[model samples]
Target: MSWGVRSILHGLDFVLQNIAWKPGIDSDLNVWSTRWVDGGMPEPVDFLLEEGFGFMKDFRIKDLCYNGGGRNEGMVRLIFKQESVDKILPTPLISTRSHDEVFWPFSDEVRYTVKSGYGVIFGEFFNNKGTLKDKERLNLKKKRFCKTTLWKLPGPQLWKILLWKIITGSLPIGSEFIKRNLGWDPFCTLCGKELKEVETLEHLFRDCDVSSRIWFGSVLGIRTDQNTFLELGEWIINWITYLKGQKENYYGLTHFLVTLNSIWTLRNNSIFRGESFVQKVFFKQLGSLVSLAIKNPVMKITNDGEGVFNSNDSEDLEDELNCLKDALLVLVID
Candidate 1:
């Protein structure tokens, strides 16, 4: 490759797949070599780098993340200043547990964007250099949100993405709609609040009295307090952690995800359908969906329009298939 093409490709490679920094299965990021610090240069791992540690390989950021005492940490402290260590501390990481994950840095929903790619490759073509939005800001959100294993829950891929978007403030809520000059009333459609307090992720999911009741009455029985969790990302991580801790309730996480999705659906209903908020039916449907998810862990988590039924879960699938066939037959007849 020519020098420019080679540089562009190298930058593109970094932009395309190298940016997001989720702590996947044993996947640790170096505070020095990797771009973990957003738009900020890393403080030197001076002594170790002299020995060619970061350039040579095998060593990683996760190596420093261990709760175990001494050994590497002693060297790490000596090698890096307190200021350098501080940046890595608030990584929104719970390192000891979690499976592998891949996320796009452009959006919290992990939706990859060409704009993000351009910004990365062309060096702030779209944003100011060294600013929060210009660099690893997108990757930071990726790291926090990958903390949730909602994708492992039983649901359609799009539904999972929708919830992820909702949690990340990327969904087209009233606030976003207003940004596009869509003539939206910048308030809680449910509560009719003022423009300053629009139906944001916090409003739709937690702050709204209607959504709060859904959480309070559910099997999880947890209502989010903005005083405790200023951000939806924090609230979601805690929620997922709560569900994961419930060992006896294997379906707890699934239940939480399903119920949240239902709540969001109701929010849409209120907005688009002009439907009044109804709690009893929402609760009933949530219960049913949770049960259905337990029986079919792959309920709608696929994209090709086919639900994968586990061999152990073949019951009633034939009848459902037959019903689908009959519906298609009716369409053909008409």
Candidate 2:
């Protein structure tokens, strides 16, 4: 096929064509080449005249290397090849972990997952301590939180949890949400004292003296200062590590998740609704969920909303505040 300067730089030619060529901007190659040729003139005006004239005839002196042919063609080919090669280089890849994964892309949850799962040497999944095998490790330690409750479903649950764990990483590193929020001094909604940063999830659920006085007392019957809320997975990992010899308590695991979820829900309601952040309210919610869990421990869930709370769990639903007392009164009637 016949080739020309336009075809030699086809892609660049297309781009330049679209750009609005203003007079001052140097789009005029005739003036540019003429100036370059005049400035770069050698001691041979007679040689320049002898060469066949073309678009870049003055600048292409190097291309006419053939004894019989002119140097103008050689210079044109050299410049064209150099410019084309410069444009041919591949573009650098610019992507994020979230673009391919199912997590909230910007959150700080990935660090927590890596810190918890790998400690320092973030490596293959299977090499880790738990059921996560190396083959499953997707190096998703820094991805966005795609979903939680993946285990409650099926297939590639580990990857889903890995993603969710990253989202949970956004949980304030310190226990104090108010302090973490920056700017304003975040006072406790219940008691208007400035909160400390290290008072995070486990603190709110288990360790915070205020929360401890309520839910922990009602549920585990503990009234102590030592129990803090560990990230649920971390807490489980610790328990599994400690109780390695004992029979696995899968039921206990389910119960623990339900209870924690209940407590977090209550905490949010109390903070946002101006509802009393009292221990009694938490106990009431805890009691209802516990009672339901006791009766229907293996509650199933499905994507189409087919199997959420079991039918039995729905039978005795009552106001969380009055549910325990309401059940007791029903027993009295019977």
- Estimate every model's Cα lDDT from 0 to 1: 0.57, 0.35
User: Could you give candidate 1's per-residue lDDT for residues 1-334 as a string of tens digits?
Assistant: 6899998887667754445454532455545555554234346666666776555355565565455411244545665666554443333343345543445555445556767666556655234533344225544554645554645545455456776786566887777888889996767766555445677788887888877888888897875553443466555655665455444565666667766666666766666667666666667666765665656543633442223454444556555445433332222111
In terms of lDDT, model 2 sits at: 0.35
lDDT of 2 by residue, 1-334 (tens): 5577656687455333322111111122332232122111122233344553344454332233234321234344344433222211111111111111122111235222423333323433324332233223223311221332334321122223432442355443333445556644344443334554344555555666665665356533445353232343433333322222122333343344444444444454555564555555556655665555445423443332212433444434333224433432322111
| Local lDDT at 56 for model 1 | 33
Quote the lDDT for 177 in model 2: 45
User: Cα lDDT for residue 16, model 2?
Assistant: 33
For candidate 1, the 10 contiguous residues with the lowest summed lDDT are: 325-334
Model 1 misplacement above 4 A: 1-138, 141-150, 193-196, 226-229, 297-334
* Candidate 2: regions farther than 4 A off: 1-167, 172-187, 190-199, 222-224, 227-233, 239-250, 294-334
lDDT at 212 for candidate 1? Answer: 83
